[model samples]
Target: MSWSIKNWRRNQILQREGIPDYIWQKLISMRCLKGLNPDELMRLRECATLFLHDKQINGAHELEITDEMRASIALQACILILNLDLDYYRNWVEIIVYPGEFILDYDYADEFGVVHHIHRIAAGEAWSAGPVILSWQDTIHTATRSGHNVVIHEFAHKIDMLHEGANGCPELHANMSAYTWHEVFSQAYAQFCHQVDKRQETIIDPYAAESPAEFFAVLSEVFFELPLITQQHFPSVYEQLALFYRQDPAQRWR
Candidate 1:
C-alpha cells in the first residue's frame, strides 16, 4: 500500500472505530504498559486501533471471543510496534486464541538434518508469513508474571521473522548497527544458554536457551514487561533492543 493510502485508511479507522475510552484506559493501566507518557499513550492507542482494524483475531476450540479480549490482545501486540510502524506486522492477519495451552504436533529437522516428529504443548506460536496462534489463558495471566507474556513473546517472533527467519535479528534501522546487534545478542545468548544448561535460576525464561530466535523472543517479553531486569542483566542486549524498537522502556520504567 502507498504511504498516502495507508495514512488515509488509518485516519478513517481512528475517526470511525476508535476503541472505547474505558477499555483503552484499562489497557494502558496494565503493568506492561506502564511509564508511557500522554503522547506515547495516544500514539499507542492509535496503533492499536489500526491493529484491530487490520488483523483478524479469532477464538478457537469453542472459545468465544469478546471485545475486551480482542482489545487486550491488540494492545499488547501493538506495544511491540508502538515506536515502529504497523507495517512491521503486515502480511499476517489471523490471531487464533485458544482457551488454554494447545497441543502442537509437527515434524522438525534438527542440527543433523534428521527429521523428527514431536508432540508437545505450547502457550503460543507465531508462523512466518502465517497466523499467530496463542493460548488466551496464558496471554492474560502471564503478563502479570515477571516478564513472561505469551502475547509479547509470539509477536516478537513475528517481528524477528521480518528480517530473515527470526534468528534473533530483525531488520535494523539505518542508524542502527547490525554488527553491534549480532555481537551483543550472541554473547548474551551464549551466557544465557550456559546458565540454563547449568540449571541455574534466571529471571529471563530458560526457553530462550532453545535457540537464537527464542532468545530474542523471550528477551523481548522481559524488555517490555520488566525493563529493569533486562537492562541490568544484559545491558548491551537491552541497548540493542532499544535501538531496534526505538523505545526506551527502561527509561519509562524508571
Candidate 2:
C-alpha cells in the first residue's frame, strides 16, 4: 500500500511540473501579483513553475494539496527568489498545510534556565531547517486584502534566517553595502518603534512594531503589495529591499 501510494504521488507530481503558461498568466493577472511589470511577472511564473516541481507540500486536516493550490503558493513564494539563485530555499524541502489556522507548541528555558511552555495560534510559520506551514484560508486570501501575505512573509523570514538568526538582516548581494543596510534598517526600525509607541498613525502595518524581524517580514509584504507606501515612507529601506530581492517593485506596483 505504501509503495502504491508513493508511486501515484510521483506520477501526479511529474504531470504538474510543466504546468502551462496560461495558468501562470492568470496568476500574474491576480491583484496580489501587483508591483511587478510584465517581464518580471513572467520571470516569477517561470521560477514558480520550477519551484512547484522541486518542492513537496503535504496537506493535512483531510485537505488535499491540489495543483492549483500548490501553484498559487509557489508563485508568490519563489517570486522573492526569482532574481536570485534557487539555492536560497535549497535548505528546506517540505511545506505543511492545514485547512485553517493551527496551534503550535514549544517549551523553552530562559537565560535563568527556568523552563516554560509556549503555545501560539498562527496562520503561518517558517522553520529554519524545516517545513513552512500555512493555512488554506489564508492562502486563498492572497492579493485580496487585510495586508497579509503569509507565504511571502514566512519565506522572507526564511531568507532572514539564511544568514544566521532572524535579526532582520538577510545575506546581501555584491552590490549591497552591509554597513549602509544596517544603518538604514536600524534607524528606520527605531523610528518605527518610536512612532508606534507614540501612537502615530503610520501607513505600514503596526505589526511591524513587534521587532526588527517582524518589521522585515511586514515590510516585505508591503514592499510587494503596497510598494508606493513603502517607497514613500521608507525610501532607503525600499531601495535596499529592491536591491536585495533584485526587483524594482515600487516602479511596477505603482
Candidate 3:
C-alpha cells in the first residue's frame, strides 16, 4: 500500500478503535516503556492501536483472551517499532498465547542432513512469515523483570527475519555500516559465548550464546529492558542497536 493510504487507514483505526485510557496508562507505567516523552507515548499508542487492529491475538488450550491481555501484548510489540514504522511487523497476522510454557514438537534436519524430531517446553517462539507463539504466564512474569521480555525477544526475531532469516543481522539503514555491525556483533557474540562456556555469571541471558541469531534476539531484550547493562557490557553492539532501532533506550532509561 502507498504511504498516504496506509497513514490514512492508521489514522482511521486510531480514531475508531483507540486503546482504552486505563490500559494505556497501565502500559506506559511498564519499566520497559519508561522515559518515553509525551509525544513518543502518543505515537506508541497510535502504533499499538493500529497493531491491535491489524493482528489477531488468540488464546490457546482454552485460555480466555481479555482486553487487558491484548493491550499488554500490543503495547510491547509496538515498542520495537516505535521509532521505526509498524511495517517492521508486516506479513504476520497472528499471535497465539498459551497459558504457560507449551510443548514444541517438530522435526529439523541437522547440518549433516540428519532429520531429528524434537520436543521441548518453550516460553515463546516466532516463525518466519508466521505467527508469534507465547506463554502468557511467562510473558507477564518477564515483562516487569529487567532485561527479560519474551515479547520483545520474539518480535526482534521477526525484525531480524525481515533481512535474511535472522542471522544476527537485520537490514541496515542506508547510513548504517554493515561492516561495523558485523565486526561489533561478531566480537561480542564470541566473547559472550566464551563467558557462557566458562559458566561465568553474566547480566545478559546465557541463551544468547546459542547462535548469532539468538544473540541478536536476546540482546534486543536487554537493549530495551536494561539498556544500561547492554551499554556497559557491549558498548559497540549497543551503538549498532541504537542505530538500527533508531532509539537510545539508555537515554530514555536515564
Return the top candidate by lDDT.
3
What ordering of candidates by TM-score runs from best to worst?
3, 1, 2
Which pairs clash in the backbone of model 2?
Answer: 35-253
Writing each residue's lDDT as its tens digit, candidate 2 over 1-254 gives 99999668756654666567666656766555766767876667667766777789999889988877888888878878878967788777899999999998989675599999979898898888889999989878866765678888999998998897688999889889999999999999999999999999977778889989889999898887777878998999999999999877767764
lDDT by residue (tens digit), candidate 1, 135-230: 988988974576898999999999989887778899999999888888888888888889999999987888899999999999899899899988
The local distance difference test score of each candidate is 0.89, 0.83, 0.91
- The residue pairs that clash in candidate 1, if any, are none
Per-residue lDDT value at 161 in model 2:
88
Q: Candidate 2: which stretches are off by over 4 Å?
A: 1-16, 35-38, 109-116
Q: Compute each candidate's TM-score over C-alphas.
A: 0.94, 0.87, 0.95
* Model 3 regions more than 4 Å off: 1-6, 110-114
lDDT of 3 by residue, 76-123 (tens): 988889989888999989999999999999997866999999799999
How many residue pairs clash (N, CA or C atoms closer than 3 angstroms) in each of the candidate models, in the order given? 0, 1, 0
Q: Considering summed lDDT, which 10 consecutive residues are worst modelled in model 1?
A: 23-32
Off by over 4 Å in 1: 1-6, 109-113
